[model samples]
Target: MLVKELKKNGLQVELKVNIPAKDVTEKLNQSLIKISEDVEIEGFRKGKVPLDIVRQRFGQNALNETLDELVQSSTNEIIRDKKLKLAIKPKIDVKNFGEEKGLEYIMSLEVIPQFKTEDLKKVKLTKFVSEVDEDDYKKTLNTFSKVQQNFEKKDGKKVSVGDGVLLNLKPMYENEIVKEAQIENKMTIVGNKMMIPEIEEKIIGSKAGDKLNFVCKFPSNFPNKNIANKDVKVEIDILEVRVPKENTLDDNLAKSLGAKNLNDLKEKVKKQMQGELDNVSKMLIKKDLIDQLDKIHKISLPQGLVDYEFNNIWAKFNDDKSKGLIDDTDKNKNETVLKKEYKLIAERRVKVGLILAKIGEDNKIEVEESDLKKAIEEEIMRQPDAKDRIIKFYTENSQALASLKAPIFEQKVVDYILANIKIEEKKISKKELLKK
Candidate 1:
């Protein structure tokens, strides 16, 4: 193996790496063996396929894996040896690859800019401060009561609003029973428009055990196109109806919700609301602090990092636009204009990010596992209905976990800066504090 620096222009370093053919063949063989273990042949059982035969069937895939593993391992070794603090991920451009010719590639690296942190004590920032209003606290209490609602089977003859009705459904399309659309034991909230608005409306005022027959017209772009743009005959058998227990704001209700009493519940609600208000205020102050830091430090932003950020922003914008979610102002902008504006935004973001990172390095600030656990726990509290899904998403997706850590680290650094800087808190109304 050989490594040589091809170019060093500003923060960008281009390296040319070459691996000898003998090592390449060794790696290719190892990959073939690993892959062949699961491959089957006509005359052999699974996991007993011959290497040559596996190569004959899956050679290209094994070779591709070999190249990727060799390149990534070599790059990691180089990055570790050089103690490289990367601003953006390295780009690899293959020059040559073959069993006999070995492998060669150019790896372009973008290193983060190193800078000394300036004293932030002189930087003055206005911090917006507010508390949860009485009205808002009451509203939150009402929300909590709604969340704690207990549904009990109704003894009345007819289903009413806010009642959960268990029912079976059958849809007929074009004189054929739509078995795929049939459902049983589906508990739907009356007047909540389950599945279809018309179905819920027709089911209201109906008694349990009553059979309902109706026709529902679906839109052309409905998920199930077989029934889309057409009226389908439907039959429903109501199994049971349950109505929500009244939400009584009292000590017993608070006890049912795990609070000591009504006052404790209010106190907890106020504290939670206040914590949210503080987060909003902190975010506003952090932005202002970052803007000041950006102005104070005139480090030459790495072009590669700026370009990477710009591409990400552009990709997100295009994705949103493709979904018809672009605002009128951006929708009217020409591509050239949008690109120019996004480029500047990207440069600012990259510059600020580099500044925060340098500060963290200088201070040895680190994100602990506990911080991530707490963050995930908070997310579960906010989205209790999607708790399992949220946990699965972060636990399974490495990129998503990294994204979660990025913000946590950023906020920690910001908090450290705030502790040192001068902040003037101005009492503001909740409306002013929360204004977008």
Candidate 2:
């Protein structure tokens, strides 16, 4: 066995490997012996065929099988011996192979780029610090008030903005009633923009027990494909109208929400908001640190890795476009422009990912069992109703578990870097902190 580094580029390598003809013949013989045990000759019993006879009859077949196995094993051996961390599977091309001649092949792969990380102690980062204020508290309380609002039945009263209405709705298209378009006792809030503006406009000022007939043309980009861009006649029967009762942020309201009193509720809200602000602050700081590192340490990115990431991004973009769900970032760009933009993003991501991975490897940072368990528990807690299903999925799917572990490892790496970095806390107003 012999290995030679044929070409070396930044983060990419091509190697030439040669296996001696004696080794190839030895492997062929071993494979032939294994096959002889199962092969049957006309006069010989099963598992009793001689190796020479088996070779005479199945020489080409056995050699092909052995060559396939040898290629993979040899490539793996060379990779291991070279200590190469591949970004993607190596491309193997057999240059020469014969019974008398040695086996030779070329293996090309993109490896993790080699670079030195800047000293964390010398890295400077700005951490925005914000304290929850009265405005935030009041806004949160207002939201809670809306969440906890009560409704009082209105008898024979006309529908108005902010009033909730129950109705029976039937939609007809082309003089035929659409299937699954009939709903009973559906509750809708006026002025909430839940339905199209035209429908809401026609429903307003209608009293209970009134029947309204109207035709509405759905927008071209409406979510329901069946009704989108189509004009449909609608029959609405107003069952009842109810007005929301004035809500007050009092002790009873707080207690109903599992708090002892209003003060307790405010304290809880403050803590939750503060935690959210802290997370935002930490995220900004981490971004700054990564940005700094990306600027200071420059290395050529692997085209294969960039292409892989770009393909993934483009696939998702196309999927979103098919579903009529283009995000703000990609809303108006043409496909060619989008591809160019995303290619840059993919390259940056691959670069940062490689750097962070190297940092984690250098520091011996890893996601421990306890960390994984805690992450799984937190995920289960987030979806308490589907705890059993989530647990079953994580147990049965190793890839899903790795997906959960990746972020944990990345965060651990970030924390390790932050611990050694100099982060300057800059106090800012809550408004400024929340601004994009």
- Each model's lDDT: 0.87, 0.87
Which segments of candidate 2 are over 4 A away from where they belong? 9-11, 33-61, 165-241, 255-261, 314-341, 383-402
After superposing candidate 1 on the true structure, give the runs of residues whose Cα lies further than 4 Å from its correct spot. 25-66, 97-100, 131-277, 428-436
lDDT of 1 by residue, 163-208 (tens): 8888898888888876756778878777665467667778889988
Please write out the lDDT profile of model 2 over residues 1-436, one tens digit for every residue: 8888899887788888899999889889988999988887799999999888898999999889878988999988878877877889999899898778869988898887777876666577888999888886788888998899888888988999999999988878887775555668978889988877888899899989999998888677766687788999999999999999877889999999999999999889999999998988887888888788777777878889899999999999889899999888778778889889999889888888888898999999989999999998999889999999999999899999999998898889889998886778899987898783
Quickly count the clashes in candidate 2. Answer: 0
Global fold similarity of model 1 (TM-score):
0.65
Cα TM-score of candidate 2: 0.78
TM-score of each: 0.65, 0.78
Pick the lDDT winner. Answer: 1
Q: Where does candidate 2 have its weakest 10-residue lDDT segment?
A: 175-184
